[model samples]
Target: MVSDRIRILFNRIAPVYDQLNTWLSLGQHRIWKQMAVKWSGATVGDSCLDVCCGSGDLALLLAEQVGLPGHVTGLDFATAQLAIAAQRAQARYPKPPLTWLEGDALALPFPDNHFDAITMGYGLRNVTDIPGSLKELYRVLKPSAKAAILDFHRPSNAQIRTLQQWYLEAIVVPAAKQFGLTEEYAYIAPSLDRFPTGTEQITLARQAGFATATHYPIAGGTMGVLVVMKG
Candidate 1:
């Protein structure tokens, strides 16, 4: 299903994934991702993990924020994406202390309570086992650490939901086609459709043993950020 399709799509588009993201979001994704990092309350010396770290955008940003004293690990299952991420990391910031690992979200290859903060951008919905992935995230995050998840939202309001659907179905897919990524982009709507809404994600976070779970709807609820604090 989506799990297989996503793996294939990302592997194929890894080289151009970051460029497509900027074009797709009109460069606003950077702002949204930065906001997600800021909302996590990550400090200068925090150890951070960026799961499903496509092209290492969030990882690089977190590394810059944490400075040389802190550690940042970006994990992704796709080798192609990881290659691109490594190239970008080396080209712009040579000798960065950040680590990029090829790993799965369901079973992270890290010790328990290892990371001070964990962030996932537009990735949770694609996980085959959403709840299981959340549990793994909670297990690795240290007590009082924050996990921020940012992804496309299914708007609860009727009018806004309709518009969001139109944008995804009509605009996004078509635009991606022009960029020679129509097949890859076609997965967007279905993925978002299967993803939980803001409220449901908050509840899932709580069920996964998060002490404090909060949801923020951005861009008029067309996208959402779920912030969960580990106990």
Candidate 2:
């Protein structure tokens, strides 16, 4: 079960989460998410689902890519985050054929084989049952559909790992404080530490019934993208 404390913490910090993320990653988070979206191979007229969509960044991007004929659903458990995402969607895209729903990742409210493609950005780490969540994603995605996940990874190289630690602890925390989100930012390192590595995530994807899985390292292995396709 997801701890109440973590949910409350995220709801409380939702407003500033996107801003803090940009600061913490020096605005690289957007690039990483965009890369994941591109790797998903979603095309025009494809229906896409973005679980743990957060502020709807990937959802909007995918919607834009899929055009007016396609549909995009952005789902998250945090109301505050969803509210912000709704407001942004209204202000920016106006009538974007996109739906924003407040929901859970492990128990998606969709029927089996519903979506053409699915993407999760910086969300797998926050899930309490990563494998279970992957299975749920697979269940909702149509046969032959693709799923792309982007998240932080523990660097394998000793020197790069050390540098990553320094970057998160030193730069991220302080930058977050500037945005009045020090406590929220402090969660980054520990969360990444607790998260499975890229290789492990690939294995999980396969175990979850993905026909094929691939991992792409970015930022010198500090971040990773896992792409999985259903048989």
Candidate 3:
């Protein structure tokens, strides 16, 4: 039910998703996404997966990183978002080595050890089952491969945590109000409250079979990237 709600929310905001992201993050999401891709160790000719690849931002970056002989798959549950991603890819390349699919993150439609690298941007928090999603990610990644998951976090510092809450209520929600997405955007605060902390995420990743896992805090702990390597 949570996944269904999130899917509906994403689909409703698909038209203004890119614009809102740029505004909300002050255009820094691009940099964060790139960081995630780099941490994944994706290289030229290495197949990659970008889960919850909203609007194909990470997937497009992965495509550039793994060019020519390499391939990238962008998977998300929202059809509207995937449609926009496909259109963007078509406009950007004559034949981009990218595939867009409408699929669930908990049950990836891929074989074990299929991808050289994987990246997930702002997706882990919304999954109905975090461990299941991580296990699925581990199952699909090649042995010795890595996955970098980027997401917003509740700052451990009291002051910064208050600031984050204020920003979401005052800035983010109001901005979404302009697009009639106030309700959808308001869920972010509650979701962040329920999301696992970086330390907890590392533990979850290891439990899911990753041999090595590290959570790198970013933006003063307001965000983080969990890098996990499959053994």
Candidate 4:
């Protein structure tokens, strides 16, 4: 079933997304995003896209890489989030000009083999069809183009799972309560539960016809990055 619930939720939380991300991740989200963008291997003059670009952080970083000639696009289904992203781009002046598009990740708006590289941050868990979304990402990327996607991970170790649950219920919930988004913030735990593990993600990437797929677990397995290379 195609549901608008996630879109609605993002629209409702768009204003606080960046701030909360920083708080929740203890300012480490930026580094993770940096690593994901780096893993994409988006060099100078490369066309890149940041899928589910909540506030254009990753897209802005990508623009820095693509420099003068290259261009980057930020795509998201949530209009409110896109508005915020556009505002950020305007205020920060992310060079190379950014194109913010309101669209679905499972159905990208670009032509096949168009983008040289892609990056996504904290988005894979929310999509309804993970495999379909991955397929679309693989489709739009040019041959040999790379993608790096960063998202929350469900720790396979029991102790780590306990830590994750505690952090979400204690730190995350309390922080989001200030914005009256307790219920919305609570979705993270369940989303992690549904998210594929690092190993499984690589297999899914292979199934999507990518020539290479690898998952790098980071932050003690609480976070992971799925890196892929198009054949």
Best by TM-score: 3
Against the true structure, what is every candidate's RMSD? 1.3, 1.3, 0.8, 1.1
lDDT of 3 by residue, 119-143 (tens): 9998999899999999999999999
Give one digit per residue, the lDDT tens place, for model 4 in 1-231. Answer: 434988889999989999998988889999999999999999999899999998899999999988968999999999999999898788874344689999999999989999999999989889998999899999999999999999998888899989989999999989999999998899888888888999999999999999999999899899999999999
Candidate 4 residues lying further than 4 Å off, grouped into runs, are none
lDDT of 2: 0.89
Alpha carbon deviation, residue 147, candidate 4 (Å): 0.5
Question: RMSD in angstroms, candidate 3?
Answer: 0.8
| RMSD of candidate 1 to true structure, Å | 1.3
lDDT per residue as tens, model 1, 1-231: 756777888898887788878887899999999988987777798899999998898888888878888889999988899998888889874466689999999999999999998899888988999999999999999999999999999988999999988988898888888779898888888888899988999899999999999999998899899999998
Quick one: best lDDT, which candidate? 3
lDDT of 1: 0.89
lDDT of 3 at 66: 96
Please, what is the TM-score per model?
0.96, 0.95, 0.98, 0.97
Q: At residue 171, what lDDT does model 4 achieve?
A: 97
lDDT of 2 at 107: 94
Write down the TM-score for model 4: 0.97
